[model samples]
Target: MTDTDLEIFAVAPPGLEPALLPEFRALGYKDARYGAGGVTMMGGWADVWRLNLELRGATKVLARIGSFRAMSLAGLDHRADEFPWDETFYSGTTVRVEATCKRSKIYHAGAAIERVERALLKAGMKPSADGEVTLKVRIEQNIVTLSVDTSGESLHKRGHKEAVGKAPMRENLAALFLRQAGYDGAEPVLDPMCGSGTFVIEAAEIAEGLQAGRSRRFAFETLASFDAVDYKALRRAVSVVKGPARFFGSDRDAGTLKGAVANADRAGLSAICDFQCKPLSELKRPDGAAGLVIVNPPYGGRIGDKKQLYALYASLGTAMKTQFSGWRVAIVTSEPGLAQATGLPLSQGPAIPHGGMKVWLFQTPPLK
Candidate 1:
């Protein structure tokens, strides 16, 4: 494909296409289309780096190198060998090949992988049995598409949060929820049930102007044509400004509170965040100021029984109405009925698909 004709893939939370589309457009990507797991746009590799660094809701960014119709194993081998594998794969680097085939003559994924590997070997590039550079091959309806994973280890693992509580929200989902709640780092943000403080940490990072990818290396860095100096220059150009991040996360579980603190410290955000071990009954608004309150309460399967979780939701709702007047509230839950238990007038925000769970983001207007 030409440099201007790149196929860019951005993985988003399920059902968040409407919310995330504007974000892609804001980044200058056009012709955006929704796919099964995320969205596809036509852009170059530079857009991939910008998405990974700037897009808060994206789970991963991939560049589609090429696609062709492959009717049989021989066709797959021919197509694989025809690509410039030498330009993509380094001689000493180990490459991991992952393939998925559906309703195609090349149904045997193992055979397809073998042929692809053989072709790579013929190109004088050795594939390590255990390596970081991953090549993802997807075959469906006699069509095969080859893509190189630009973001390794999923962008959600932002290199913080060494310890996570049960049923912790991924960083990408947390950022999406924050965006849905109208969090722009200018207002005070609180996570009352902040297990491992994912929301608060993301908020702090945004408020502080931190680059999400600064702490980690991306797979694109290993590409043959990738310019390390240019990447560093681009990274340096992304300015980070420290701001008053009125971000707070409180959990009754002391262990989770500790985890949040540790994560914030590692992320260089401890000074900007306030972590506490406090119950919902004692939860107070930050300095009695109107801000955003986002909570991911205990779902039935994870920490509490169904009956107890219902009570938790009920109490959470009561507290929000009684104590958090004029504060916008966003609650994330797998159970829609539990949101009803909150007893607050909530408008359904979005039903985001996450990790095989269909989750609803419920929002309530600021209590008068």
Candidate 2:
């Protein structure tokens, strides 16, 4: 493929590919479709930059540069040397190479990595364990696929949220979960167990039409293909439309609420986001039109005792039933029983891996 025509992959947490695809499609990637662990589409370097800046559900964006078949380490080195690395990477750029082999004659990943590193070094690149940019080599069935991690840090960082609470939901996953719950920034959003204000702040940012990567620097900036002038113009062209929906969050832990407020302020969403110290039992629907109530509660697996979490979840259910009429609800928890304890008419969604545990999103239609 030419420099202007390249394969772009948006990596997401396993099982969230479906949730991430619509985002690319909505952003004008008509050919975008879900893959095993993410979504893949064909575009140039500019698309790579835009995806890194705009995709909220992606954990990172990978640019599939090129690939070749290599049955042996010697062959791998030969092919790597033949490939045009100078086209995308600048000499002396610090990089780390990672490899995975499956059902391939080149079974040793270390050997494969060494071959690739040697080739890179021959091309004037510096190979370091602590490199800022990563090159992923996947050899499956004797076919090698080369991809660069265009996002240096995970996209979840968002370069904001200076503080985080215990077992906080990541920003990318929170955005995808909000989308899965049918939230589109058109209605108010409430998170009763808000920790660090990830959900509320993400919703507020989405409502304000803020760019996901506005505050961050991407790995693509170091690549030879990057265009600072073009990227700056792209960033400048994104205009924010202040949505009318208000985002609210509450938690019994006053200290956590304090941090959440700080996070909202850092995200520049404090104007539309309201944080308070309150328990689930004290949760009341906002005065505005009904919207979405999304929460990530303690499931015994991570934070609290299972037996006690059921009661907390039950209390959350009671609050929604009594006060949040016509508002949709989504609860993220590891235990199906904890979600069932909510006792709301819920639908269990695909299991998503989070913080060393598997969690599912349990949602409901508008509460009658």
Candidate 3:
């Protein structure tokens, strides 16, 4: 926190580690590499802000403030008191303390939380049962580590898309899927069953080079190291330019299409995005270079029986093969049988966990 060399952790969606690694390195963190659940990099508070603001694939950012060794509750209280509170937390701020302990003398997390809370209260910080600022205390093998959750809400919220269709894909996951599908922001993107427009909107943002967290607020603003003037300067340097390539999204439900349009408008991408009520059976190739088409169609238990969904997938496959010559396709679904029913030459994609269901992106070479 006070130190400019604190470790910053960027949480990535499971199965996208390789995709996230190159992103952090290209963002100038040479030390950025894959960690257990995310990518670990060395940076200060400003870097945390930058990651929260700009990184599209990271679902959350955690800043490791400091650490110590405490074998007993007395020892923990003593060490927590000496932490430089003035450098990280504002005085009189309400905060919540959450602790986890394993294989340590201070094995009781509740007792550990009480000790930390008492220390923070002694340092003029108020304790709130539920607070925006969270103090994560971890004790393992006689070592204690403390960190802060910089992103207020999950980064996937992205402060856009108020209307979400049933089983809507998270924004960050959509971005990673786009990258894995080989989208470089230079080509058109379409989603035949675009429920609330997550893929298409994410594509438009990537094409326009817009920051993912541009319209969002963060919990880091409540911390002591936050510099309002510096943050404003950082935002001033962000340039947004709409690209010429248009993104298209269509759904059979007119109400669903309306929600997609509203979400696009909120993201400031309505100008280059086209939405209409169209079913997969009638999906036609747009007049342009055949680009990538990514879709997360409804899969099992929520929409229809396996037999019915097979027909939908078959219709999608037939449409792509018949009309979309030279177009690449990515179909995300939880049912393998449905994917196979498409009848297109599909390569097995990595299995990504989505909404508690394991989904894979079945990709095809350009339709011949």
Return the TM-score for each candidate structure: 0.93, 0.96, 0.95
The total number of steric clashes, by the backbone 3 Å criterion, in model 1 comes to: 0
Q: Report the C-alpha lDDT of model 3 over 159-198, residue by residue, as the tens digit.
A: 8779888878899999988988999889999899999999
RMSD of 1: 2.1
Best by TM-score: 2
lDDT of 2 by residue, 1-368 (tens): 56457989899989999999998988899998897989999899989998988899999999999988988888998999998888878999988999999999999999999999999999999999988799999999999999999999999999888888988999999999999999998889999999889999999888777889998899999999989998887784434334443999999999989999988777767768888898877787889789999999999876888988888888889999999999999999999998998789999999898888899999999999
User: For residues 1-368, what per-residue lDDT tens digits would candidate 1 score against the true structure?
Assistant: 45668888888877775666666776667678776778888776666777777777777888887789999988887887887887766776677888999998889888888988888788877765676677888999999888888888788888766989888899888887888888877888899989898999998887776777777788887777577765666573434335454889999999989999999888888777899999988987778468889998877756578777888899999989888889999999888889999999998876666657778899988887
User: Which residue runs of candidate 2 sit more than 4 Å off their true CA positions?
Assistant: 1-4, 237-245
Residue-level error in angstroms, candidate 2, position 359: 1.1
The C-alpha lDDT values of all candidates are 0.81, 0.90, 0.87
| RMSD, every candidate, angstroms | 2.1, 1.6, 1.7
Pairs with steric clashes in candidate 2: none
Candidate 1 Cα errors over 4 Å, as ranges: 236-245
Model 3 misplacement above 4 A? 1-4, 236-245
